[model samples]
Target: MTTPAIPSTLDVALWLFDQSRRDDVYLPAQKLQRLLWLQQGGYAAMNHGRMLMPAVFVADETGPIEPTVFHLFEDSRPPIPARPIDQVAENHLVRMWRRYSHHSPDYLTKKITQQRCYRDAWRKGAGTVIPFEAIVRDFTDLPTGDQMVRAGDGRALKKWTPSAKPAMRRIR
Candidate 1:
């Protein structure tokens, strides 16, 4: 069996960034984790296939802005095998966030939200198992806009869509 062309962790982070900007919301890091968890079968829908989970951002008491929750519809699906939370968080998502935290507090907050969202959602039946195939279908059918550019050779490229792209500052 050939390996699937699922989005990399970086790809997902970039996508989340775009989504947050488009929605005019800030998604904490934990929320990104939740998104990954749901996509990776954090919910019972993994048996079927990949899922396309939808997320929404909301503000908390801190007023710093964060992803309050993930809206998981019965129709969404994920695109990869659901790995253990530690593996996904520690290895890919969190690692990437740490690399950017020094210059980007917003990114750090979004990462935090992803984690919180996952735990909260899991407690509220997001992890209930379902027909894996159905979940996969949901993922496949979800609408994804062109958030990245591709070279003629099919190499992925980052296209700055935000009005003013966030600067990359050295982390101390």
Candidate 2:
């Protein structure tokens, strides 16, 4: 089987930021990290073990985070400069944002941390890397894994085209 191309951290972050902008909200970097983690794990569960993106995650002071994403929007601000994302990735990201964007960052963090994958990987320590296998294992055990497979099969998020418009809402 062929491996899928992994998106750079910049493209993924901008794609996520673009979705939040469309929904008229700003997703803090902390929350965005959680979303990416979910997106990666969920996709892996659905695609016969293929990771949507190869982002490396580490347990941070707040939660699991991709270091590049953390630094990209570390200011807790928005309007991150847009970056290009391919159609396949954009479709997955759009659905991911639609599914999880409504939750507050703190809530997302709490929810993910409570998951078995995050909890098990976190046993290593704050700076330790969370293995991709742990994440995939976690998703495969949940109902959301089924949803991700359906979303990929249906291409349900293709209708939402991504744009570079700046974020309209500020984190309150």
Candidate 3:
């Protein structure tokens, strides 16, 4: 694939961790992986297949994981040289956090790994790379994506919380 929108994965990870802290929650490594995967999928699906970060996802039996991030964050967050993210990309990530970060780690794992992309890659064998195209397809049709399935009043599907302000970011 071509170069990703964000120069580094740590940039996004830092932003996510900050957001979780803002909400008074601890971000687990597994949950962070799912957010990264979802952000990649959502960005690609909505923005003509451009990736959100320079990361590769592999099926790990448990779920899809950005290996570089998975290993680096395996125990805990290592010393990171966080970089500024593009304003547009930051906006997209903010939306992603609001949309899905409220869900539990197990919930995210089930929802993401159950998709055809993860299933096919995993069936190929553990650590198989999931193509960006397959991920784009999965995200495009996801019921919980921006194109959410409508229900009566749709209030039950809504996940946004009114915040005083957006999470702070070092903009590019």
Q: Best-fitting candidate, measured by TM-score?
A: 3
After TM-score superposition, what is the CA distance of residue 71 in candidate 1 from its true location, in Å? 25
Please report, as a residue range, the 10-residue window in candidate 2 with the lowest summed lDDT: 151-160
Distance from true location, Cα of 23 in model 1, Å: 0.4
For model 3, give the RMSD to the true fold.
12.5
Ranking by TM-score: 3, 2, 1
Compared with the true structure, model 3 gives a TM-score of 0.80
Full-model lDDT, candidate 2? 0.72
lDDT (C-alpha, whole model) for all candidates: 0.37, 0.72, 0.81
Residue 36, candidate 3: how far off, in angstroms? Answer: 0.6
Q: For model 3, how does the per-residue alpha-carbon lDDT over 47-93 read when each residue is reduced to its tens digit?
A: 77788887789999789998888888777777886677889999888
Candidate 1 lDDT, tens digit per residue, 1-172? 1222233443444554454556565555555544443333322221233222332223343211213222221223234334333343334333333333233444444443334333343444534323334333333333331112223344554434776767899999
> What are the TM-scores, per candidate, against the unseen true structure?
0.27, 0.75, 0.80
What is the Cα-based lDDT of residue 115 in candidate 1?
43
lDDT of 2 by residue, 1-46 (tens): 2354455666677777777777788777788888888788766766
Error of 1 at 138 (Å): 16
